[model samples]
Target: MLRSLLPIVEHAVKGPVWDCQMCGQCVLHETGMTCPMTCPKTLRNGPCGGVAVDGACEVKPEMQCVWVKANHRAENLPLLPQSWRDEIGHLRAPVNNSLAGDSSWMNLVSGADRKTPTGWKGSE
Candidate 1:
């Protein structure tokens, strides 16, 4: 019951504002409120090298590069807590496919989202 309902509520609240993709491991607080999962390439850490010189997305030329926007927001967005913005430089772990469609709010509280497969390069 907890798992099933959390996703619906999470999506309903976050979807309209952030266009969240419910990757089951949310890093929006660290990401300047942008949803990295919504990137055309779904890049977790940062933007692809294909970003144009003008800061436009290479995959979707009309839009600004997601990372470019994230960085700007992380620095300039008012009312962002300093601790949440401090992690912008961290290397986000790769997506855990098994957790797709699950509730990230629950995963976050239980620390389930941080579990990497054995031998994963991101594992400590």
Candidate 2:
């Protein structure tokens, strides 16, 4: 009844959210078939303790964890080397606007450059 209709109504209201261009294959093919793009936290290394031993994502228990899927994908690709695992040790936080060369967003959002320091002097 209402429960069955809910899905139809929801789909009509929020259509196309589930559609993906499959461009994500680029991440897999280029990076040892490991997909950091689809991950919610976008972890490139491994699970963030947000998955159970059974490979269920803590954020969404009903769905397979991204890390687990990535591991499986990696296993099948013989050409894919394990070198990426070494690089993960030096993983840095994904840069946002400030570090992505879009400093204007940072300035607008954080007001970082709204005023100069009190003692600062600049040539006119």
Best of the candidates, lDDT: 1
lDDT of 2 by residue, 1-124 (tens): 6435544554443235432222211223333345454567766556788798789888878877877876676556565666653433333333232222222223445554333456555333
* Model 1 TM-score, 2 decimals: 0.92
**How far off is residue 16 in model 1, in Å?**
0.1
Clashing residue pairs in candidate 1, if any?
none
Counted clashes in each candidate structure: 0, 0
For every candidate in turn, the CA RMSD to the true structure comes to 1.6, 14.0
- Stretches off by above 4 angstroms in model 1 are 121-124
lDDT of 1 by residue, 12-115 (tens): 99999999898999999999999888789999898889999999999999999999999999998999999878988788778998888988989999999999
The whole-model lDDT of each prediction reads 0.90, 0.49
lDDT at 39 for candidate 2?
Answer: 65
